[model samples]
Target: MDEVEKNKTVEKDMKKLVNKSWFRYWLSAEMSNSYERLQSLSFCYSIIPVLKKLYPNKEEFGEAVKRHLNFFNTEPTWGSPILGIAIAMEEEKAKTKQIPGEAITSLKTGLMGPLAGIGDTIDWGTLKTIIYGIAVTFASSGNILGAFIPLVFTCLTFIIGRYLTNFGYTVGKDSVKSILQQGWIKELIFGTSILGLFMMGALTSNFVKIITPLSFEIAKGQTLVIQEILDSIVPGLLPLCAVFGIYYFLKKGKVNYGVLAIGIVAICLVASFVGVL
Candidate 1:
């Protein structure tokens, strides 16, 4: 085929690979999760259509499927972009027949960590907190606004997810070098982490309620309330302390979650029975 015809054929193939139906497949990217490879099976499943188009021979198609089915796991939301880029790279490999399976696998593995970090920081740490914060405020007021707000947020995220998938394919292999070399990914992670911490503090203060009812006679008639004294020193002092205590235990990693939960329940029950809380 002539150069122009080859270019036209590549464009047609790429257009076919990244269509509306393909985006639907990418959206179901986490449906086949497993403990062994996590999203590896679904990841392979998402790109099967592309693989079929690129690798005509049964042996080549099988090899391509196996190559993608190795080990793959990342945040499903932002990870769609990585999937798009991988599809483009696989297309190139099929055309040139030079890129080895190891190279492709290595690329996927290397990108997973960084992409997951970015995705978790943005999606879980920042965006989720913002959405939940707003929704909870409305729900606390006994309004349906909270439910509708989260539904809107979910729709917006779906659209953004689709866009990221297409963007990844559009950027192709440069997606890795561009993200790492430019250093913006690091800045994004740092910014989102700081925001997440601030949100966590706000949630703790608003939700965690702790107070003491103990009272002592200071002199002949004067009485001192322990909770009032603690509040005077710092509002939510007990709550802050409780949070830090739990954080300390969690950081230690020696205590199981179930044991910690039971311990907290036991402590609360004892304290209430003794009238200390």
Candidate 2:
């Protein structure tokens, strides 16, 4: 009975520790971003409490912290399951001394990239696009509720993150390999990619404004209008081309975003001034 009570107390403390780590991560996941290590410091900061609780020995605690501080970056909300798995593994290591420190490091490095991709697609691309699309519809009609829609989405992210963190804890380390081997994640990525592309296309058509006023005489009392010709061939062709051009430069990874923005504005201004747009 005494051992049972002790186990209960330890379990309670562990839950508290995990919750603290999750809260810290939610608040400051990107706050400590740096070019060199990116989210490493933030990840380390989030799990510090859990590590301290697990490794009471000063040297072990220091080693654990340093182990986590090595080049970690991920999409915080979706990658939160990794945090829970880390905590579970740390607890196992503290108890058994069988799990190598290198194993933990490898787990984080391996999972971060894939989870980041998933998070970016689902959370940033699809979810935000859907939410903001609705918000924009409301805003267009001067509805004050549009402002609160994003707040609701932010809350939903926290809820989803908390649930995923708990899920990782429940699954532990062994199940991750099997889960990754399955088709669900890939299917999810494919579905979300399609939805995101659809949303982006809709947004481009509605918001990206480009038109031409250029015209020339094809014959006596007949004129050829460039914008009309473009419309006849493909509606919103200019805006689509513009979007594709920007996407191309961005994918090349060499263009500075600030410079790109300035160049775009300059082109627009010049086109307007010359009556080509």
Candidate 3:
């Protein structure tokens, strides 16, 4: 085949390999993971279409599949960009046969950590806090808007995932450098982190319920309520203590979440029975 025809065929195959519909499939399936490989299996599955088109031979295709099935785990929403870049790299590798599979794996390994960190901070920490804070306000007032608000806000993540995936494909491997170098992205992350922390504090004070009903007789027909005295010193003090104690326990990593949850329930029940709460 002439160079022109070969180039045309390659372009056509590339177009067929990935599109808007493919991205939707990838986005939906990104979280399909196992305890062992985490997202590695799903990550391979997401790009299977492209890999099939690129590696025509059965042996090459199987190798490609195994190559991608190695260990990988990251936040799905932000990890779309890495998937896109991988697709681009795979395309180049298929056409030129110069890029080793290790290069691709290394790229994924290097990018996953920073991307996951940023993604967790922005998506889980910041966005969730802001959206839930707004939702909780309505929920506390017994308004139904609280339920729908968070659901609507979740759509934004889908949009972001789509955009980042497309952007990664367009920018290719350089996406990592470009994204990390963008001053505005860093600033935005920092700003959102602060806002998220503030929202957490608000939520802690408003929602974490703990109180004391103990009272002591000071004089005839006069009594001092322990809760009232504590409130006079600092409102929500017990709640704050409760929150910090749980945080400390969780941070220690010795206790599993299930155990911690059961402990909290048992403690709460016992405390209520004892009239301490």
* Model 1 spans > 4 angstroms off: 1-13, 19-26, 173-277
Candidate 2: deviation at residue 123, Å?
0.5
Clashing pairs in 2: none
Total clashing pairs in model 2: 0
TM-score leader: 2
Write model 3 residue lDDT over 183-257, tens digit each, in one string: 333443455455445655865777788988898899999999999989999999999899899889978989876
Going through the candidates in the order shown, the clash numbers are 0, 0, 0
lDDT of 2: 0.83
Worst 10 residues of 2 by lDDT: 183-192
TM-score of every candidate? 0.57, 0.63, 0.56
Residue 173 in candidate 2 has what lDDT? 46
List RMSD in Å for every model shown: 11.4, 10.7, 11.8
Displacement of residue 131 (Cα, Å) in model 2 is 0.7
C-alpha lDDT (0 to 100) for residue 247 of candidate 2: 90
CA shift of 178, model 1, Å: 13
Q: Write the per-residue lDDT of candidate 1 for residues 1-277, one digit (tens) a residue.
A: 9999999997777766665424655566678776446788878877888888889999999999999897687887776777777887787678766556665676677666567778889888998899989999999999989878877666766777678877888887464345445754445345545554565586589888989999999899999999999999999999999999998997898996678888988999999999998
Q: Give each model's whole-structure lDDT.
A: 0.76, 0.83, 0.75
